[model samples]
Target chain A: MTISTMRLTGVAAACAIFSINAFAEDSSLTNPAISAVLDGYYQSAERPMSERVEGFGLGHTEVAMSANIDDMFYGKLTAVIEMHDGETELGLEEAFIQTLAMPYGLSMRAGRFLSDIGYLNNQHVHTDAFSDRPAAYRAFLGSHYFDDGVRLSYVAPTDLYWTMGVEAFKGDNMRAADEHNERDYKSTGVYTAFTKIGGDAGINGSWQAGLSYLRNENGRMTAEEHDHVAVLDEHDHEHSHSAQYTGENTYVADFVYKWAPNGNYKYQHLTLSGEFFRVTDFKPLEEEHDEHDAHDDEGKDYQDGWYLSSVYQFSPHWSAGLRYGQVDTQMMHDDHFDPQKLKETEVSLAWHQSHFSTVRLQYTNQQGTNFDGIEDDNVITLQYIMTLGAHGAHQF
Target chain B: MRINSKQFLPKALKTLTLAVTLGFISNAQAEFNIFACEPEYAALAKELAPDARIYSATTAMQDPHQVQARPSLIAKMRQADLAICAGADLEIGWLPMLQMKSANAKVRSTDQGLFFAAEQIDTVDQMKSVDRSMGDVHAKGNPHLHFDPKRLLGVAEALTQKLMQLDPDSTAQYQANLARFSQRWNDAIPRWEQKAKPLNGKKIIAYHSSFKYLFNWLGLEQVADLEPKPGIPPSSSHLASLLTRAKQGDILAIIIASYQSERGADWLGERADLPVIVLPMSVGGNEQSVDLFSLYDSAIDLLLAAK
Candidate 1:
């Protein structure tokens, strides 16, 4: 089917769902708050970008339902629907139950949910000022990370805002390797801890800073295995594959500052945010034939990346944003791949028709060194995000 | 003899818990911590509980409906003994998020620690059915009932009862304060009405339903709204249509709240040659509006000047 036809069908289905929800007669306090986000984008570029598809495509869309289970518990479930390579795919994004009234400012959540590690990690993509997350997130976290986990968080009693949280996850989704190897974990694989502090800068401004750490019990990440494996190139030619680097630890530091006239965000505002990521204690994995050659894999490896972004709302409906990100990856000595560094810069303008809808136009330029001959590319994209039904409140 | 480490740890924890509980009990008796979603409620709270430590979540220069659930608010909510807000979905956007994130068992929607000012009093403009397409309508009613003196007295009575229930030790003090405030407020209401007598039957344009109760109380008519839809901004096409009605010269003035952007009202005022008046919506809305009494005085003075 044509892309336009598919888009029309998707929109029709969403509207139908909304009408059914609106007309439903069953009203009870236990009934969940239902909402849906519809996201679509059109891109023009010479080559497919890292996180963006070429031409017309449906982006990340989600339907979520949430309710307080009782006075003590709250539950939420979100299902993601998107187009991948001209085919529609559906997946569960989040399903969690959190404590509502834990004493001493403590709360616990369990089930599959996004880890609260960085400023932008747990927030929905539809709430983002830009069409995409920064390059650091795309490279290290595969855009957004969610897994089966349990989390416990505590808010301090002091006047200044401070929170600390810990999480444990089954790392199947977070593992860098798509194909499992002998070193794969059997059970709980990823553990994380994070602390955040924030306060009002003034009547018109607020600032928050956070530090986070993640440890992978089993192998954490895999880089290109460039040694002996042969992989087919996009041009239908045989090429050496990239090697794997099993990471043990990752750290993230993030900060955000927001300002508006007299704390009023209805008209004009500015947001400045940045995040830095580092991966350490990485050990390159050898191919199956060299399983006994563990001595060669003992060398430690490291990688780091960071991104900075600012968005200014010039008027009630229009906002412009600029972001720059860079990532450096260290690879083993090989013929197919060398240590690579990628830098990306993005500028975007968003028109918020209302609180529920946004149309964004963005331009991105990426520069890469030792990136399989695809060094530099410029891409432009137009995207729309529309919320239907009971849109929930945004969190900081 | 060396103490067993495991047993000693539990003992230490117990002591810590007792100390913290004692500290909280003492603090509660000394001063009740109150979290008010808006400044008007904070002013009301201060009247009833003079010794209470009050925190207003939103400033006078903020649209309460558009407040962000900032971390500082969550922190304040966590420490509050009681939360006072104009419910009826006025704070639906951010209050629930704050309540959940605070995790302070005391202040959930169903908890006694939470009080809704609008729910305690009758409101105007209630609807049986509502939709977002209608632009941010509340199914319960217009939530900006604080401007109506009669309804505000009802809220004050209900809030005094609530505060007494939460802090029973200060019930006599609360009753005394309520009596004094109600007497003064009742007296001032008539004076305000007398001053606003000139505004009766006068027509004006407004930005939102923020002053619905005020208009109803003063016998004023809202001829038009700057916004085409309740929440939507005024478009050029809608403004152009309003220009025709504006030329009829029935509109006494273009009125906007202190927190609202004046662009739309200014445009209409310029084109129609009408007086543009910015009214203080609540306490602390302007320098002169330092309290509830001053708030009403400032609002009436501004509207009278425009008239």
Candidate 2:
């Protein structure tokens, strides 16, 4: 067995050298740059959430390849691999082609991609300072809103940085769950427009602020638990019924400010960012048997949320952050159902071993009031993120 | 429809006026714009073109290997007529992203407007084979060729040709500028050689391979590296081993670039009873190193002071 193992190892070494020589000769100029990110976590939570797992689990592991297809176009493809309920699942995260050279500072992108609606939505999960996204993002955007889309953006030729963009998407991926199976949409279902402006405060500081609007042609179905009360049947058994709401429009405003002494991120830095989101143009869709129909006539149905976070790297390897997020929902204007609210606070400490690797420990507390009554839970998670191969540079 | 027409008319007039004003400004100042990745190249372009507007993406106080692809830099690249950089994977981290993001044809690698300075000169330490375990080695060779005065002259000639090709109307001017600059550079080389004669064959420790070209030019030897590996910072274990090596009486002082952290070098210097010399690695690295000529002068002066 030992002799065979040595022979195998010898063969492997020879092949490796041969491949390296081949790669050096001409492969790099023709082959796409390949990269992969591995994320894993161990968490202990009093109550399980959509993203928080109880024990050891994979988190957002992905492999990506990108290259300029020609003089005019660049392409990238990213695939995600994860375990869901003891089953391995493979999915395409993004596959997009972007224009390399367009006239008048205009660029276009087409394919399945993350929407450029908010500051953190377009960035991958591994790039996040904290282990989990803010509560508002989870509730409103399902953590991130990615779908098949085409986008056209224009960068202004000005001293101060400014860009404007518009996008249209199939929107099947971004739609909310329909519990009653009452809604359907075909063709292009989502459209978005956004504008961002940024400038450097000095050599040590820079900031960007943006406002975005999303219009969903097909509205979403949501439960209105505030107004409906439980009714007792003839057998003296309690039955619960709630009104339904359909929401359409969303607006997001985000801002970020970063400061690094002498513009060097290697040693120390601070990042402060916040986002506000609102869902409007919502109305009552169904009320079971018309008993709660009075709530349908009421207007001004809306939902809004906001989050603020700050991460400070005091040393080269260590960083700590705190985030607070709150989301409120008023599906109906009537007082029969109280407004539902969810709030979460999180604190995390990360050890960045290098630019490509990080280990983080996070603590989270969630408190909220809904039809399920007041909820309070605490969670602790230990996570690691590592990247390998030719990774692309991160954007500011 | 009437209200829309009124809004459109005003917007159209404002855009037309802005366009006309911008056109006038650009035409009045028709000098070529160059974006250099490092300060040394920026200074060189200024010497060669004299009239061209130039922007340096990084200063001496910053590391060129890893730079934030900031939006302002993208804006600068979008307006650039030519982009020049030390391109033997030295800018592998950020420059490609800048090229793609700027969506500028002139700055793309495949275009004639983007120039790689390292390609113009045969560099030292060209590796036949490499790996990441070897600590960020470039297969093409060392990209810090600007430190070698002889190679830099060759680069100046190539850049003069490139400038002429891009701006044909100024061919005669560029030729004159190169002749004058080369003459002055040729005269200064021997003076620098005389000043640095005593420093030949000296051995010193450094943070990274950033000074290999400079050492090669000056005939100095690198004794040990402060970093445990290429691109990695010096750890306690590595420093402890270096402490024993520093006691061997022949080793000179520890040298580091201006942008490097002083902690590791200072610790070694304190324990080993050696001087920690901070050399200005590029143009504008120090007040005295305002340009290329003074940059070398300042570096040699600091090394001599340490000796």
Q: What are the per-candidate TM-scores when only chain A is compared? A: 0.84, 0.82
Chain B TM per candidate, please? 0.91, 0.93
Give the range where candidate 2 chain A is weakest over 10 consecutive residues by summed lDDT: A232-241
> How does model 1 score on DockQ?
0.65
Give DockQ for candidates 1 onward, in order: 0.65, 0.50
lDDT of 1 by residue, A73-172 (tens): 9999887766655445456678999998788999999998889999999888778887777767765665676788899999887678899999998866
Model 2 per-residue lDDT tens digits across residues A93-129? 6899999778878899999778888899888888898
lDDT digits (tens) for residues B1-307 of candidate 1: 9999999999999999999999889865656899999999999998888798999999888999888888899889988999999998888789988987788888886347999988888778899877778877788899999999999999999999998888898899999999999999999999999999999999998988989899999998998888787777888999898889999988899999989999888898999999999998788889999889999999999999986
Clashes of 1: 6
In model 1, which regions exceed 4 Å deviation? A1-31, A46-51, A178-180, A220-246, A285-300, A331-337, B1-30
